[model samples]
Target: MALLVDELMTKQPRPLGRSLILCASALSVALVTGCTSDSGGPSASASSPGQQQKSPSNGSDLTDEKLGKQVEKTLDTAEVSDSDPLFVEAGLERVGDGFHSVPDLTRGHSYKLSVVCVGKGKISLSIAVKNPVRQTLDCDGVTFRQHLTSSAAAIKIDGDGMPGATGMVGWRLDKADK
Candidate 1:
């Protein structure tokens, strides 16, 4: 009986030890994930003592309304004549969320594209269907313009925000006459 008891005790330790290790690993993963995950929402604007608080691009706090207005103002600033055929698309998005505008463009045609953003961090702009043209724009409430000839049957404009970026992003794409 003593021999049987000793054998059972020895056999129990392996499974018991493995269960403990698995539990510990799961707990560690849960803790780490909880500590590092973002809530995907706007954070409160607060500053610690003696820390300089930076203002947003439009001389005001960032909001969906403000972002829309900024984009509208940017689109209006384009130099398109009133009678020219124009295609425009704009949006207000989170800083890290990407935005895109896909428009059917004539092949071998000329057009002017204007993009703008008001927020923190840099936005990556990519244009064209194949072999896309890419550029980075600083989110400083400034409009960027580019003129290009269409190489594909359609044009796609994408803006991606960099990691750990804050504030709102806005853009406008104006399809111009040939």
Candidate 2:
């Protein structure tokens, strides 16, 4: 049994510490945001590190300019500089299960995916590049931000497969400053 365990450990691709660190970081972020509940509503603490407190929008139309303003406010509150060029800034509206695919993304560049729900509904968001899954987030108040490292030609934003899921999901994709 010992030999078998050692062989299995040797066959692993990534160092175990990397996975542990990732899990720890995710847990810390979750704790900081106070999003430990599964109920669909506003989070107890919506402000992330360096983020300002803002009232949750109540089913308002999320136009391009409005979404841009929200993204800018988030960036400003998070202390993220606006010197970096935006790769994609678009709004997505869907009534059922669907995905938005973004193609021709620059390799080795970091990207931020910000999602905001425009109406009253529950949403679960995920990201994928070809076959590999990258990140998944489900939060209340229908807002969350995820940082991703791009390595593929395209990426897909999935907002589906959740039971009774329906809403207008607004998204903003920005490239991080190198």
Candidate 3:
């Protein structure tokens, strides 16, 4: 009976020991994760007196980056004159987006321009599609949606509030696939 009692006591400790070790490990991990996580906690450096907190991502892009890339890929970057043999300046047209007016795209010729993402929050990109291909333009992101048509009256490209950057917006030309 004494031996039997001793055997049971030994077996009880095996499970209890394992449980205690597991509990300790879990507690350690919980403490570490809570301390090291990036949940807007002030860094040790920034927590110092007279130091300010830094922002996470600049929040530069949302939807316009993807759309602007698509536009740039479809257009060409070369400049052509109204009488240039490779392509002709069919005309310029305005693209409208609610309250903002986009740059003028030339038809009868493909033009390529660049795009940029503004700082954090709102997305922005600019393109300079030139006539006679003569200018490197800084433009605004909201202006790309204003493509009226090549046949419209000579529309002007407005670079209002455009960041100083540039990108390839899109191209215009006939069905020749140039």
Best by TM-score: 1
Q: Which stretches of candidate 2 lie over 4 Å from their true place?
A: 1-84, 95-97, 118-121, 130-139
Q: In order, how many clashes per candidate?
A: 0, 0, 17
TM-score of 2: 0.44
Candidates in order have lDDT scores of: 0.69, 0.58, 0.39
What are the per-residue Cα lDDT tens digits for candidate 2 across 25-105?
A: 999998966655433356545545655555445544344336445434543423444454565555555535345656457
As for lDDT, the candidate ahead, 2 or 3, is 2
Tell me how candidate 2 scores on lDDT.
0.58
User: How close is every model to the real structure, measured as TM-score?
Assistant: 0.53, 0.44, 0.22
Please give the lDDT score at residue 96 for candidate 1: 71
Q: Predictions ranked by lDDT, top down?
A: 1, 2, 3
lDDT of 2 at 20: 94
For candidate 3, write residues 41-156 as lDDT tens digits. Answer: 43545575665666543333333455455444433323445565444232221111201234344554343322222222222323223322223323343322322334334434
The C-alpha stretches of model 3 lying farther than 4 A from their native spots are 10-20, 23-36, 39-54, 57-178
**Better model by TM-score: candidate 2 vs candidate 3:** 2
RMSD of each: 10.5, 23.9, 15.7
> Looking at model 2, which ten-residue stretch has the lowest summed lDDT?
133-142
> Across residues 41-152, which tens digit of lDDT does each residue of candidate 1 receive?
2452334455445555454444756765666676674344546556555566666777877766667776677777776788888887556688988888787888867774
